[model samples]
Target: MTFIAGWLPSDLNNPSNDNIAGPDSVAIKGPTGGFLVPAGATVSNIGFHSKNAVPAKFSIYAIDFTLLAETGGATTGGAGDELFPLLTDWTPQVDTYVYVAALTSSYLTGIGGDANLRFMPYASRVYEDGFPNPFVQAGTANTPKQALWLDGTLAASGPSIPEADDITDESQPVTFTLSGNENAPTGITINGEVGSNLIFVSENTGAGTETYSYEPPLIADDDTTDLVVSVDGATAATVIAYTNSYDRDQLTHPATEAEYSENSLSYPNAYATTQPYEWKVVTDANASVVTINWNALEADDGFHKDVASYATPVANGSTTVTLGVFVPETGQAYQFDRTITVSDGSVVVTGEGLWCELFRDPTEELFTELFR
Candidate 1:
C-alpha cells in the first residue's frame, strides 16, 4: 500500500555520512557504460540533479541494445532537482539497461560529486527488493542495500502489499526473496493470516537468494491475499498473494461470446474505466443454503469486487447474478472464474461457471458519436 518511488540509490563508498565515498558516484551516459536498471519494471519519469538547467538526451535500451524509448534534449537541469516525464511507460521485460547522454553530443557534463539519476517520473508501489538490512544503531550509517525511512518517524514499516493477485492453486508455493541476506526470516503472513508451517530454502538449496515459501492452509473457497515476511520480529516485506485453489479448469474465460450486456448504464461503475457483467445460475431448492465464490486466475481477469455466491431466495429454475461485477479495491480483472456449491448435509456438488469475456470498462461513446 506504499510507493517505492524515490531518488535512485546513491552510489557511495563509505557507511559514514562524512567519509571517503565510493568511487561509483559519477558515470558517463551511453550504451557501453551506464547504470544497470533491475529488469521487469515500469517507469514513467526521469529525475536527476545537475549543476545548472541544461539540455540532454536520455534513452532506455534493452539488453540487446534495442532502443526501447528515447527522449530528445530538453531542460535537463542541475542542482535544482527537476523531473522529466517519459514519452511512455517503460515496461522492461527483462534485465534492462539505461543510457542517458547529451542529445547534441554524447559529451555528458559536469555535475555534483554524488550524482544519481532516477528514471522515475512518478512513485510506483514498491515490490520487496531485498531483505531488511540489520537495523543500524544510533550514530551509525546504514549498510549497503538497507531499508529506508521517510519523514518524521511514527509509522508502520515493511514492504507494501501489491494491488492484486491472480491465484491459481489451493496449496500454492508462495515465495518471497530477500536480496542477499542469508539469515532466515522469523515469520511470515498472508493477507494478515499467518501460515501454520514454513519452508525456508535457498534459491537453489545452495547459498544464494533466500526464498521463503509458505504453504498456507487455504481452502478451495476463492481467496486473494497478501504475504507479509517478518525479519527479526519487525515487518520487513509484504506482497500480494494469489491464493486460489490449485485444481482448476485450464480453460480461460471465453472472450468471443455474447453473454454480456455491453455498455449498459444500469451498473454503478458502467461509465468508469471498468465494466461489470451479469449472469445467472441454478441451485437446488432442497438445499438449506447455497453460496458462490469467484477468483481471477489471470492478471487480465476482470474482477474488481468479490461477489458472494449466495443469491436471492430462489425456489424456481434459476437466480440472477452478475459476473465480473464485484472487484477488490486493487482493480478489475478482464478474465475470472466462478464456482457454485450447493449442500443439504447429505450431498454437495460444486460446479464451475462458464468462463467468458465479461464487461470491460473505461470505454464510452464519444461526444460526436453520441450525437451522430
Candidate 2:
C-alpha cells in the first residue's frame, strides 16, 4: 500500500517565495499531471496548514471543474497550525485530479496580518502501487497559476421586507443589494425565478455594489418562497417570504358534549335544541374575512335540521353536524364535523296494568305518573 503525505511546494528550497498574499483571494492548486487519487484509492483526513491564525472558506473542485467539496469556514490557531476540518472520506471510481480554492477572511491586512495567510493541503491516501508525486508550485511561476488575490468584502442587504414576513400584497416589488469584490455574484434567483435588471453601480479594485429588484409572482395565499444569491455558483445568502392565509388548525368552535339527556315526557320528541354553537376560523392578521357555511345536520333517524340556526336538534340516535369555511385570500375552503347523541328519559313502562312510577330527572326533579 502507498501512503501519500501532505502537499509540498514544487521547489522545496524556495518555499517562502511561494506564499501568496491577499485579504479575500482564491488560491488553486492541482491537476498535477499525475492522478491525485487512483481508482479505488481511499483518501481521508483532508485539511490544510495555515501560516497565519485566520478564518477562511474553501471550495474543492475536480479537474473538470466539478465541485467536489467545500468548507464553509474554518479558523487556524496561529502560524504553523494544521486544521483538519470535518470532511467525508473520498474513494473515486476512476483516477482523479483534485483542485482547491481558499478564500481568506477580509480581516487580513498587511504582510504580517491575516491577509498574508497561506494554505497547503494536508491529506492522507492509501493506494496499491506507488503513483507519481503530485507536488506542484504554489505561486504564479507555473503554467496554471493561482487566481489573482481579490481584496474586498462580500455582503448582501435588504429585500426591503423582513425575512419570513407575510405578504398580503404582491404588487409591491422587493429589492436587494449585493456589494463586494469583482466577480462576487454570478446569479440571483427569487422564488425559483431568475432575477432581472441586474445593475452594477460602482466597480473598482477596491469594491463594487449591485442592485437587484424582484417583482414577486402571484402565489397562493399561505404559501412561502425565498430569494437566493449565489457567488461562484454557490449560495451566499437567502431571504424568505410568506403569503398571508388561514391556519386550519387554529379553527375554533364550541366544545362538543358527547351526549345530551332529557327527562320530561311532556317535551316534544325529536325537538331542535335551543343551545347555539358558534364556529370561528383563525387567519393571519392581514388575511381577508372568511365566509362560514353551516351545512345541514345529518342523523341516523329523525328529520335533518338546518345548521344555519347554529343549533342542534335532539334525536334518539346520533347526529353529525358539518361546518365549512371559505378563505378568500387563499381561495381555499375547510370543513369540520362533530357528532352529538341525545338520550330521552331512561325509564320505560310496559304491560296492561295500573302502576305508579316515580323517578328523579337530570335536574333532580321528582316525577310521579300513572300508566295503564
- Most accurate candidate by TM-score: 1
Q: Where does candidate 1 have its weakest 10-residue lDDT segment? A: 146-155
For residues 116-164, could you state the per-residue lDDT of candidate 2 as single tens digits? Answer: 3233222111112322123433332221222211111211222121122
Error of 2 at 238 (Å): 2.5
TM-score of 2: 0.26
TM-score of each: 0.34, 0.26
Candidate 1 stretches greater than 4 Å from native: 1-44, 47-56, 60-69, 72-82, 89-99, 105-182, 201-209, 218-222, 236-372
Model 1 TM-score (2 dp): 0.34
lDDT tens readout by residue for model 1, 1-372: 112122233422223322111232221122323333433345555554444444555555443334666555586544544555557766543333343322323221222221222221111111133211111212112111211111111123233222223445535665566543345666766566566566765554332245656666443223435556666545665445353433322222322223222311121123122223332122222333433332332222322222221232223222233333222222333222333332232212222222212222222332122223
